[model samples]
Target: MASKQHRLTGTQSAIYLIISITLNALGNGITVSLNLGSALWTASAVNLSHLVGGDLKLLLMLIGFIAIIVNMILLGGIQWRRAINNLVFMIPFSILVGYSATMFNQWHLDNLPLVLRIVLDLFGIVMIATAVSIYQRVNILLHPLDDFMQIIRFKFFKGNAPIAMWVSFIPPVTMSLIAIFISHRIYAINIGTIFSLLFQGSLVGWADRHVFKTLKHQGLDKLMTAKHQ
Candidate 1:
C-alpha cells in the first residue's frame, strides 16, 4: 500500500512538472527574443546621449567581458560537479543573440511610437521567460548568473532556493530601474524590464524543482547522459 501511494504521488508530481516545463519553455522563447530587442534599444538610447567617448564603449565592452568571465568562474566554483558537457550550448546561443541584436540595431527604431516600443519589449519578456524554462529542462550547467545566485543563497540561507534567487536578481533590476530614470525617462512604468526578469527567474526555479523532477523520474536524464558526458 505504501509503495502504491508513493507511485501515485510521483505520478502527480510528474504531471505538474510537465506542465511547468511547458509553460516555462514558452516563457523562455519570448524572453530571449526580447533580450535581443532590448540590447538594441539600450544601445540606441546610449547613442542618444551626445556625449561621445570612444574609450567609454571600449570600457563597457571590457566590463561586459569581465562580467561574463567572472560569472563563469563563480559557476564553476559552486556547481562544479553538477556541471555537465551540454553547457557549451551557451556559447552558440550567445552568438545567436548577438547576431539578432545586430540585425535589430540596423532597423531604424527611433521613429517607432511608444506603443510599439512597449510591444517589442513585451515580446522580449516572453522570450526571456521561455529561455528560463528551457534552462530548467536542460539542467546542463546553471548559467553563471544562476550559479552566482545559488552561491549567495547558500551563504546566507544555506538551503533556501527562493531567497538565493531573489538576491541574485535584485541588483540587476535595481540597476535597470536606475537606468530607466537616467536614460529612458519613462515615468509611471512599474513593470519595465525588471518584471520579465523576475518572472523568468521565478519560473526557472519552479520548473527546475517540478519539471526537472518529472524528467528524472521518467528516466529522460538517461537519454542525455552520453551527451552530457
Candidate 2:
C-alpha cells in the first residue's frame, strides 16, 4: 500500500507541476497579448529584455539565476545542489512562458475591443492565482523568484505569508519602475500590474481554502503528502 501510495503521489506531483506551469504560461501569454503587463517578477524580466536586447526567456533565466545567487548569499552559504535543481525548473518554465507569450501575441489580441481585453486580463490573473495555489500545494522545488521570496519571508517576516508577499513585491516593482524610467516606455508595468499585485494573494488564498479544500475532500490532498518513504 505504501509503495502504491508513493507512486500515486509522484504522479500527482508531476500533474500538479505541469498544470501550474501551463496555467502560468497561458496567463503570461494573455498579458503579452493584451500588451498590458505581467506579474511583478515577470515585469522586471520583460523590461530587462527590452533594454538588453535578448529574448525574454533568456532575460528571465538571468534574473532567476541572480535571484538564486542572492538567496544563497543571504542564507550565508551556497548550496550548489539546490541551485542546480532550481535552475532545472526555472529554465524550462521560462522557455514555456516566453513561447506561450510569443504565440499568443502573434494573434494580436491587443486589437480586440477594450472590454474584451480587460476581461481576458482578468481571466489571466485568475489563472495565475490558481497556478500559484496549486504550485504551493504541490510542494516541489519552486521557481527561483518564489524560492527567494519564501526565504525572505521566513527570514525577515517571521514566516508571515501576507507580509512576505507584500515585501516580495518591492524589489521587482522597483526594478520595473527603474527600467521604465530608463527606457521611457512601459515594458511590463501598468494598471494590470497594479490589479495583479493587489489581488493575486487574495485569489490564491481563496483557491487554497475553497478549490484546494474541495480537492482534498476528494482525496487529492493525499498527493500533497505522498512523498517516498
Candidate 3:
C-alpha cells in the first residue's frame, strides 16, 4: 500500500510538472510584454514620492513583499521547494547583496563610465547564472513564478524542463534590459542593482545546498517517507 501511494505521489508530481510547464510559457509571454510598463510605472511612483522622508528599510521590505505577492498572483501558487530554499537562503543573501548595492549607491560612483557599469552588470549576470545552475541541480520547489511557468510548460510542451527553465528566467532578464535602457534621477539602471539579483539566486542556491541538502543527506527524506506511511 505504501509503495502504491508513493507511486501515486510521483504520478501527481509528474502531472503537476507538465501543467506547470505549459502555463509558464503562456504566462511568461504575457509577463514579458506587460512587465516593462509595470517597471516604468513602479519606478515613476517611487520617484514621485522622493520628497517624502520615510524608513528606507520599510519601503524596501514592502517592495520585497509586493514582489512576492506579484509572483504569487502571476504564477498562481508558490513552489514548495523554491519557497523553502528561498526562506533558508534569501535572508542572508539579501543582506549581503542589498548592503553592497547600498554601498555602491552611496559611493557617488555614477559618474564612472557606462562601460564600467555594464561590466558590473555582467558580473551580476554571472552571479545569477551561478545561482540558477546550483538551484537547478537541487531539484527543489520552484518559486511561485517558476512553479506557474512550470505548470504552463507541462500543459503545453508536455513537461519540458528546459523550456520551463528558460521561461522562468525571462522576467529578471527583461528587468535587467529595461533597467539598462531607462534612467531617471531617482532610479537608473546600474550594475549594482542587477548584480543584486545574483544575491537572490545565490540565497536560493544556498538553501538548496545547505538546509534541504542537509535534510536529505541526514536521511530525513526516508524518515518523512516512513512517517507518511
- Identify the candidate with maximal TM-score: 2
Q: How many backbone clashes does candidate 3 have?
A: 20
Model 1 per-residue lDDT tens digits across residues 40-89:
22333233332232353453444344444554454343322344322343
Model 2 Cα lDDT, one tens digit per residue, 1-229: 0122232267777887888889988987788678776788888878878876789766777788888788677666666655776778776776887798898888889889998898898889888877776765564656777667556655676444456667778888888778888888777677678788888767766776776453321223222232222
Worst 10 residues of 1 by lDDT: 220-229
lDDT of 3 by residue, 194-228 (tens): 33333434443343345423221111122122121
The estimated TM-scores of all candidates read 0.46, 0.77, 0.38
Q: Compared to the true structure, candidate 1 yields what TM-score?
A: 0.46
Please report, as a residue range, the 10-residue window in candidate 2 with the lowest summed lDDT: 217-226
lDDT of 3: 0.39
- In candidate 2, residue 136 scores what lDDT? 59
RMSD for all candidates, in order, please.
9.2, 5.8, 12.7
Stretches of candidate 1 off by over 4 Å are 1-90, 105-113, 150-163, 173-191, 205-229
Q: Give the poorly placed runs of model 2, Cα more than 4 Å off.
A: 1-8, 49-55, 74-76, 154-160, 214-229
Ranking by lDDT: 2, 1, 3
